[model samples]
Target: MADIGGKRVAILATNGFEQSELEVPRDKLREAGAEVHVISLESGEIKGWDLKDWGRTVPVDRVLSDVSADDYDALVLPGGQINPDILRAEPAAIDFIKAFWADKKVIGAICHAPWLLVEAGIIEGRKVTSYHSIKTDVVNAGGKWEDSEVVTDQGLVTSRKPDDLPAFCAKVVEEIGEGRHERRAA
Candidate 1:
């Protein structure tokens, strides 16, 4: 467990997020001493998608228009079929993710959430992993897709699925500890 005390992390999510993907990382990161906030397209709360059904709702800590990459040390993107699909269509959401990359802040995307990465145009030429179903999307986006529990390229971290959340969250904390990375080549 890395001591990320006082570090600020943002978990970008929306309705239909994979239940565990959002909760596990958020809880674990908080337990590791980082201040974690849930940022979404709207205020109030967002519903989650459990393995086979709609799961619990998580309260939003901040709205997308209210924050930026400069407000946090790291950013997290949790995936679900519906969540990323919807978020990827939002220009503001994509720009938020891009800002994190421009600043070289730690960015973590798992499962279908990599779709947001593809939309943000940050995964190109970077090594990453996501739920197997989204492998082609990642590769097509020019990312070096890997079949691994977790992959880290520069300060960007990615994982395959809920089963990989443990490694993903751990690496996120580690990357936050390392601070920002250098910009990637165009």
Candidate 2:
């Protein structure tokens, strides 16, 4: 793992986030020396959805109202059917994601998490991959969706599912280490 010793990464998620998707990359990033924070709709804790049922709870480090894209070096979006669906509907969350995209900061999204990216209007013309169920949504949003284990476009990193966590986390660390990327003019 690369040493991101002073970098700060924000995981934007809410209740019902996929358990593994949220935890795996977070633990991996933390182990690589990056400061990781869980930012959500509120303070206190948010629960995870483990496949069929509710999973463990993670403490909220900061609330969406209190943090901005400038607060971190990279932004992570963890996917769960419920998590992204709720987040995509929240204007604050969508705006926060848009700010990160506009700044060319590293943005990592997995599974259904890309829904937020689609909602943020940053997916058009970008190459990405996500859980199969949302393939149509990504394509409909103008993104070139692939079936690969992981895909990286500019500073954006995305993966297909929870099983792709190892590859996803590695690419995220690599991209964050590379810092901001320049997106070609549309």
Candidate 3:
């Protein structure tokens, strides 16, 4: 697999982000030389939810309102039901994600994270995967929802859940390392 080698990746997450979904990929991406930045709606720290209880707190590097999609090579959305749900309701958060699609940057979403995609109105006409519960939402939003553990459609890559993290991270790193292309930017 190719290394990201200093590629800047943005992870848009907030309180209630699934612990593994956020930490695993972030760690792997950084290990491969990607500069991972956690941007959230909060100013200080964001809490993570382990399967049943509170897990840990990660410092928020930037606020959603401060990010420009053009400054990143890729975008990551870590799912936890609450995280994306809250984000989907935030205008700035949705706009930040919309800018990523407009710029054609690699967009990686896991579990229920794609809810933000549906809210941003960018999944239509594309194939994607997410936590099975929201499969209908993807379809309803005009996206071709799939049952696969991972799906990579165009510049967008998605996965089912924490179990899919390995493949998800691998695909995300691949997308980021591929470099930007005009087709994605348009």
Best model per TM-score: 2
Q: What is the C-alpha lDDT of each candidate?
A: 0.93, 0.96, 0.90
lDDT of 2 by residue, 61-144 (tens): 999999999999999999999999999999999999999999999999999999999999999999999999999999999999
Off by over 4 Å in 2: none
lDDT of 2 at 158: 96
Q: Which regions of candidate 3 fall more than 4 Å away from where they truly are?
A: 181-186
Q: Order candidates by lDDT, high to low.
A: 2, 1, 3
Worst 10 residues of 2 by lDDT: 177-186
Q: State each model's C-alpha RMSD to the native.
A: 0.8, 0.6, 1.8
Query: What's the residue-level lDDT of 79 in candidate 3?
Result: 99
Arranged by TM-score with the best first, the candidates are 2, 1, 3
lDDT of 3 by residue, 98-179 (tens): 9888887899999999999999988888889999999999999998888898898877999999999999998988888776
Q: What TM-score, over all chains together, does every model reach?
A: 0.98, 0.99, 0.95
The Cα error of candidate 2 at residue 70, in Å, is: 0.8
Q: For model 3, how big is the CA root-mean-square deviation?
A: 1.8
